[model samples]
Target: MTLQLEDEQAQKLPFDYEELAKQVIDQVLGMEECPYESEVSLTLTDNTKIRQLNREFRKIDKPTDVLSFPLVDFQKPADYDLLESDGWEVYFNPESGELMLGDIVISIERASEQAREYGHSLKREYAFLIAHSMLHLLGYDHMISEEAAVMEQKQAAVLKKLNITREGE
Candidate 1:
């Protein structure tokens, strides 16, 4: 698995991208069921840029901390799919090959504010968001109470493994 990160914000992030990427990839690979070689792109941008993206893609008309764009369907158990839509050919990489899983867009400004509000270090908050995004990339969802609880537990476990804890822990 490969995590391609792009920092487009002027604010400085507290964690190293290489280390963060490794941690995320490691957590993703820990899942025994996943078979494909995954590729994910993460972009850190300011509120303005993220707002534009949110409006354009989700029609939210506001900025959010993280947004996930999944490239393939999670319901199907296939290793990969080669699809042709709108005259565009999209190939889900084979299990042995590189598959573009999806993209995650994060807002550094929002993260910083949340860190302060949550009374935690920026590093911890950022890691949590990254892990959450990674789970979404891997087809984890929290649309309901039970699913949300499970996802939250998994996220907490992953964060603890990374030595990241919430404030007042």
Candidate 2:
């Protein structure tokens, strides 16, 4: 797997984001039963940057903790199709030689707040966000209740595999 992370945030967490991001992505790919090589692009930014993105793409005008831009044409990574439509774009990486999955933008400020509110370590929060974004890259969505439940289970399983559990259980 190839994960390109661009950290544009001012807040510096304790964890090594580059390393942990790869581990979390691998864990999610394993959970999803991905057969071939995969790729993902991640960006760590502050609220302002994420807010700009949210306004441009989602038109929500709010900085969300995480945003997913999946490239797969269909709702499943088994095909890994890069259907050209809307703002979706796909490309290959010369470094890792892996197929491009999609892009993920994470708001560091929001993540910190969520970690505090959820009572988990910053590392655990990062792991969860990265894993959650990986699921989105693999065509997972939480728009519906059933899909949300399934995605939650998959995220939990990925975190469990890496021993990146939530604090106090």
- Mark the regions of model 1 whose C-alpha exceeds 4 Å error after superposition: 76-96, 167-169
lDDT of 2 by residue, 39-107 (tens): 888999999999999999999998899999976645554444434345443444556656677899999
* Candidate 1 per-residue lDDT over residues 1-169, each given as its tens digit: 7777788889976668658766855775574246555678888888999999999998999989989888766553223333334422243555546667788888989999999998898787778887787777667788889878977888888878777787434
> What lDDT does model 2 reach?
0.81
- Residue 7 displacement (Å), model 2: 1.1
Q: How many backbone clashes does candidate 1 have?
A: 0
Top lDDT prediction, candidate number? 2
CA error at residue 28 for candidate 1, angstroms: 2.8
Error of 2 at 83 (Å): 10
User: In model 1, what is the error at residue 120, expressed in angstroms?
Assistant: 0.5
Give all TM-scores, in the order shown.
Answer: 0.83, 0.87
**C-alpha lDDT score of every prediction, in listed order:** 0.74, 0.81
Please state the error at residue 22 of candidate 2 in Å.
Answer: 0.4
